[model samples]
Target: MLTYYMPPKTMWSNLSKETLRIYLDQAQQAYNDLLIGNKPISVSYSQETGAKSVTYTQANLQQLQGYILELQRTLGINRRRAMRIRFR
Candidate 1:
């Protein structure tokens, strides 16, 4: 007779199915928020290689907030959730 069997338990087995599902859902949402909401806009810029070279821009709080707002609207996610992913 064949002795085909499954593997031993894993760490994830410690968590209830419902709890694991919720955690997975939250994690997926957080990742989606990051992809859609985290964008860097030009808050400042300076030329390092003279005017003929490409410009380098700085990112700051103001540009981050503006982009977050735009992303929230576009993604249909709440401001808090977007901010959580950004700050986390």
Candidate 2:
């Protein structure tokens, strides 16, 4: 089975932008999979001295979303909708 690694959030700024982009892509793909009824998504990440695997469930959907947003923000690629209002 192929596995993807998620770098620690604290290390995001230090990672090369290319690496960060790869991570962001992985995160977004996982999030999309979960949204379409995929369950128990697995992601690996380094913790302390070793790598650990985390399984994300439907219950953790929001948390996954937060990760996506955080990554997007870090990459400065988050899409923000602009609104305009006019009153006469």
Candidate 3:
């Protein structure tokens, strides 16, 4: 008999659910840019503006990996439907 082991929740507690959501959002943006064949998108910040803004294709790979993991959390039915809808 084989025993499967799952890691403790504390290992992931450092990253809140909201953080995953934010990373997923960024991944979607990067994918959209990739679809449009855009490269090296610009990211800018301003002290007076109190915010940063830009449009480009550069994305954090670690964040994207996390987003992929998030997508993997979904079931097969929903994942299949999403893939079909997204491509068409």
Candidate 4:
């Protein structure tokens, strides 16, 4: 049983690159699991200046994929390949 906790968006900026990468990897794994018909538990947390709140959501492919993309963007990871042309 795999459980994934989504850190608050505010926390993302405070996270180190390695931490973001870990989250990205976990999100991708959860996305793949959902594709294979497995529903993992997804927990989310929200924090205010003086209050903290927690919410639970059913794992969905799209959400996980979106999170992964967000993490990649934060990490400056570009997946697209550049095409090169050679002039003789």
Candidate 5:
């Protein structure tokens, strides 16, 4: 028999269930930027102030991905979505 030790609730008490999903979505968009067939995530446009701006969502891609992975592990969130696909 195998037994898994569950972490105390306090360890993950502050982690939101939606945190990983939100980050995953943002990160996926960023990840696709490098794919040949997929559309890029970055865009250039002007703000209301008429200033040119570049919108590159991937700027925090690394940080988002890291937090997502960490929250997934800490919250055991991946175990429940083994074959689930969610779109928003």
Candidate 6:
């Protein structure tokens, strides 16, 4: 059953289903963190060049958030379940 959601044209669009799922989870987590006014998201990378090892960090808060929103919009994830509460 095909729903109305389609993947957009992005760098991560071609990822495997499992990889995409992992990224989606991470993106949602980062979005929630940002909403709660927490620290910026960071991704670390280490490179080796024969006799040299360099380590650096990439601050990816905005990018991750943008991708998350884009994914949500393109994938029709904007729907929220209705909730009802009653106290007597």
Best by the TM-score measure: 2
Question: Per-residue CA lDDT of candidate 3, range 1-88, in tens?
Answer: 9754433343233455565455446656765666577775444333333755655444554544454455434211123322444554
Name the TM-score of candidate 6: 0.45
Instruction: Please say which candidate is ahead in lDDT: 4 or 6.
Output: 4
Which prediction has more favorable TM-score, 1 or 6? 6
TM-score of each: 0.33, 0.67, 0.37, 0.55, 0.34, 0.45
Which model, 3 or 5, shows the larger TM-score?
3
lDDT of 6 by residue, 39-59 (tens): 665422222322322221136
Model 2 worst lDDT window (10 residues): 3-12
How many Å off is the CA of 51 in candidate 5?
Answer: 31
For each candidate, the alpha-carbon lDDT, in order, equals 0.39, 0.74, 0.47, 0.60, 0.50, 0.54
Cα lDDT tens digits for candidate 5, 1-88: 9867564464334546575355446545555663434433543323244634333443555654664466566656555424778999
Q: Pick the candidate with the highest lDDT.
A: 2
In candidate 6, what residue range of length 10 has the lowest lDDT sum? 48-57
Overlapping backbone residue pairs in candidate 5 total 0
TM-score of 1: 0.33
List RMSD in Å for every model shown.
19.9, 10.0, 11.6, 10.3, 12.7, 9.8
lDDT of 4: 0.60
Which ranking of candidates, highest TM-score first?
Answer: 2, 4, 6, 3, 5, 1
Q: Candidate 3: where are CA atoms >4 Å away?
A: 1-13, 41-88
Arranged by lDDT with the best first, the candidates are 2, 4, 6, 5, 3, 1
Put down candidate 1 lDDT per residue, 1-88, tens digits, no spaces: 8753332354344445554445445434444444565432112212333322221123344434444344333333452322444554
Name the lDDT value of residue 65 in candidate 1. Answer: 48
Candidate 3, residue 25: the lDDT equals 60
User: For model 4, where is the 10-residue window of minimal lDDT?
Assistant: 47-56
Error of 2 at 49 (Å): 5.5
